[model samples]
Target: MGRRPMPVGTYGKIRVESSGPKRYRARCRYRDFNGKVYDVERMGTSRTNAENNLKAAIRDWVTPVAGATVTASTRFRDVAARWLAELVRDAEREFRSWGTIDTYRNRLEGLVLPAVGDLRMNELSTPILDALCKKVRDNSSASSAKTVRAVLSGVCAYAVRHGALDANPAREITRLESKRAKNRPQKSRALTAVEVLDLLKRLDQDERAAKDDLPDLVRFFLGTGERTGEALGAHWPDFNAEARELAMSGNVIRVRGRGRIVNRGKT
Candidate 1:
């Protein structure tokens, strides 16, 4: 059965300041289960601006839920750990990797546990998620914030699947969408026979200034057709006698880490 969407609304906020100075430092803050203040500084100089900021923060915090109570006491760090443990258990070899589990662990140990870690799962809210993502974005990569969202989504989705919660709190928090890079025309590498002959002639001259290791390096590159890093990382054991093949470990030899490599047996 499909789950129904949760109710969302605008929430009002409360603000206070010291000394009643004309120049008031107005903040948009959230109160948690333990009665502690969590600030969301969509800051403003004027009281009206501050109030608006606070109310907007509040709306962001509470509007996602139909009528759920949010508080610091509500999120339990232990529960997150438990869920991660379960993730490790249920994951298949292809589906699970050291990196993936490490991601789950990082979310629990690094972010969630540090804030509202002691509370029950029912207490998590969109505002809290928003604040956490905002903080991470300030000091960390956009990808890291997105990782946090994925972990949170898993935990919240688990809660919904188990009937422990009505809906995933993570579903309401909007992701900070990354800006798309404008596509540029790529320079083509295809060369004609005449161009290849020219390149060979240039290389013959270029060989004079080439490093002492260049000949061996170029020979290894020609034999293996491996990239610079892969060529450097390869070992003698990777070659097979019967199959006449060479093996490479992708995780062991990383490029840009946007995706995972298929697992081959460890060396």
Candidate 2:
């Protein structure tokens, strides 16, 4: 019978020996995550210290999986690409919407990747993520910062699942605050009936608005109270004149690479 091999990511039978007057060395055969075994050793001033050092080294050691796309040393950009691929797969499986996938990809390419793409997975600490998000919030709008934060959280969570990280650092980032919202308080008031009629009259008088069918679209919105996308996605089949009802079953959205598409309504 052949000798049994050590399990992957584990080591066997540490041996410690004196190397010099006060120096000691510990050695073992470690099977890495890739299922390859290698002789590993670590030195210390004493026997116990040497063994502990070797154990610590074994604990901290990281190697790429045989066919995995992510590792501790893999760049953030590479991991983001893998994560994006997973998102696309999710969209195909109907677990996620194509619109959501598009939003994530746009944020990754425009903001998250540009800031941290070159960094290694192990380098993404909580402080670094916090700083990155804060910088984005200061430079861009709060909505953009929120999107960036969400994207980072997804990427780091994926890293954790792939064994590239211990925990998701983005989770520790502080909540993003909207400076615009803080500076400008929103006032809520509905338009008067006269104002609404005046607006409709202006839409009816404008040649460009008339040519673009904005008046009818605005009328549909006023009558159904549906979102612009939902109203645009409405088809003749969705409306029943006998029942005087319109089914809000789809939403119009522009998807990257696929252009405009009608998807199931948000509600």
Candidate 3:
């Protein structure tokens, strides 16, 4: 009968031998996930050290998938880079919005990466992620904390997918809470009819407003109640003169590398 192949990601028995006066080498045949077997070896000062080094190497072995280099020992920052690349690809395919991708990248670089970027994939525990979320909530705002939590979850999920982790630690974190809600007062109020008229009169008198066409823009906002992006994205073709109506077809958004573009409007 033919010899059975070793299971993928498993290695054969190790053989240690003296290479020099005090140097030793451990060697083994490892079956990678790609169904190929290769010789793996590590050198150390002593027999025990050589065996231990070989074991460590096997523990950290990862088959590169489509140019990916992530492993169990890969730093969190590296994993985040891979995840961001996937997100950018999704954006390119039109499966995700570039604005959303930009938001994730900004939150990762601005907050999440600075906190745990150096940690290895295997070192990210639930408690560590919980502490990160709490610290962001206390130092920044609840909204910022939520964004950081989401970015962490995404990165950790990517690591899990790549066999770097068994599960996503960020998924076990508690929800972020805002402590300033009780103390903060509301800052926005609807303008009265008289106030609206007064504001328009002032806009007409201001030369800068006239030059910038602010009055017309403000009128368009008030008439349609559409957001700034939606109003700015409107074209003459979207308007129906007979019905005196404009179609809400798209919104103007600025992507990082592509600059401003008209994206499909929210439903």
Candidate 4:
């Protein structure tokens, strides 16, 4: 009634059609998937194909099942995939930039679920999590691994949020260190007098060379120190040119490229 213990790194092969005495062989092979050759332990005559397949299975290189949606089953890969599909659905309507949705979709399909996809959701453990991390650590950039880790963490979070899992095992994985980014210093750089003069000369040259509206845009940028929206909102009729001052009277700044109202001004 109980399941047999797996031969830690082995498989049992029972002798076929031997009447004199029952005999069996225990075998195992450890083949590295990261570009290493097939190797067998205690079985020099082992078939190459079998060893290859066993190595692939051990490496979690399971091929995908075609046309199967992840939601109908509780497989770790399936759930993770379904969670990402759901995320894409939500993001299509909610996301402001194409880049955000694209990045999320790619990470989900390419990294998060592939390592753990066919596994039953409840069967996921620290060992499985460790293997996934190791896979990412082997070939990906450090930042990329961190990003994939975040994706996997979120995938596990989704499982917990939807009652598919009790706790996210990925939460136990340590975050990858960001080596490429430098911390911002507290001090701000003040322009030197010569630097300021150089900037003025450049600005003057730009004023002479820039077409139609860009020079004015630059001047507006310098004047109010507000973004383009605020400048566009201000009308010449509302300004006293001789006084070099303007009253907004009734105007509002709306950010373009994004659908949101963050800044508005009227005076």
Candidate 2 Cα errors over 4 Å, as ranges: 1-28, 31-59, 62-66, 180-190, 198-211, 240-245
Tens-place lDDT digits, model 3, residues 74-141: 99999999899998888777777777888888889988888899998877889998998899889888
Q: In what order do the candidates fall by TM-score, top score first?
A: 3, 2, 1, 4
Cα lDDT tens digits for candidate 2, 1-267? 999888888889999999898899999999987788888888999999999989877776755445667877789999999989999888767677778888889989988888899998877789998998899889987788888999999999998888788789999899998874546667888888999999999999999999999999999988888888888889898789999988777788898888888866344
Between the candidate structures 2 and 3, which one is better when assessed by TM-score? 3
Which whole-number lDDT from 0 to 100 does residue 244 have in model 3? 100
The residue-by-residue lDDT of candidate 4 on 1-267, one tens digit each, is 897554444333422222223322223543333333233322122344344444444444222234533221367766766666676566455433334445655766788666666777666776677667666766676666766777777777776666655578887776555455377768887667787667666766774546456556666766677655556667778789899888654333333244443223234
Better of 1 and 4 by TM-score: 1
Error of 3 at 220 (Å): 1.4
Runs off by more than 4 Å, candidate 1: 1-75, 177-250, 253-267
TM-score of each: 0.45, 0.70, 0.75, 0.42
Which has the better TM-score: candidate 1, or candidate 2?
A: 2
Best by TM-score: 3
lDDT of 1 by residue, 171-198 (tens): 7777666545479678778566787567
Give the 10-residue window scoring lowest on summed lDDT in candidate 3: 60-69
